[model samples]
Target: MKLSDFELDVLQLFWQHGDCSAKQIHEWVCETKPSAYTTVKTIVDRLEDKGAIKRVGKDGRAFVFQTQISKDDLTPSILPSFVKRFFAGNASSLITHLIDDEKLSDDELEYLENYLAKKKKSKS
Candidate 1:
């Protein structure tokens, strides 16, 4: 499912905290920056509408939420669109940007290399 930046941010919080109310998610989000409670709730509602999250329960008159879709589940679905939009559909350009502009550390590079190697082996 396509999520806006705000929706994705909220999802990350749900993933981290597990099932939680919109108020709890809002509180967590507000730690980083100030935003209206309604705004956060609106994002959460949108997430529900998109089927990215499900109503897990309720707490003190507020609905609790949990993820229906994982970040991994969303990755392949969104990646090609991202490549097209941001990287002009160039895989090499995406890799180059990550390596150069993203300033990935040696450890991260090694990890990604190992991951790529494993994928290549699996394909072969």
Candidate 2:
């Protein structure tokens, strides 16, 4: 499902926190950027409409929500389009840019090497 950046942001919170109310979401969002509670509520409503999240229960007067989709399920669908738009559909270019430009620690680099080795071994 196509989601606006704000919707994705809100959806991520549900994935991370498991279940939350709109007021909690708004407070979390406000930590990084100022957002009106109504704006967050509207995004939450949109997410529910998109089936990305569902009302699970309630916290006081607020409706609580949880993610209907897993991050793993969502990433594959989004990654291809992201790579196409930014890296001209070249997955290798995306990986290369990240390895070259990003500050990956030794442990992270080792993990990537091990993952690549396993991937290559599986293909052969």
Deviation in Å, model 2, residue 1 alpha carbon: 1.3
For candidate 1, the per-residue lDDT at 95 reads 90
lDDT of 2: 0.91
Question: Which residue pairs overlap in candidate 2's backbone?
Answer: none
- Per-model C-alpha RMSD: 2.4, 1.5
For every model shown, what is its TM-score relative to the native structure? 0.81, 0.89
Task: Report the C-alpha lDDT of model 1 over 1-124, residue by residue, as the tens digit.
Answer: 7788788899999889999999999899999989999999999999999999999778889888889998899999889988999989998899988788887889998999999999999999
Candidate 2 per-residue lDDT over residues 39-93, each given as its tens digit: 9999999999999888989888889898889988889889999999999999999
User: Against the unseen true structure, what C-alpha lDDT does each candidate score?
Assistant: 0.91, 0.91
lDDT, model 1: 0.91
Best by TM-score: 2
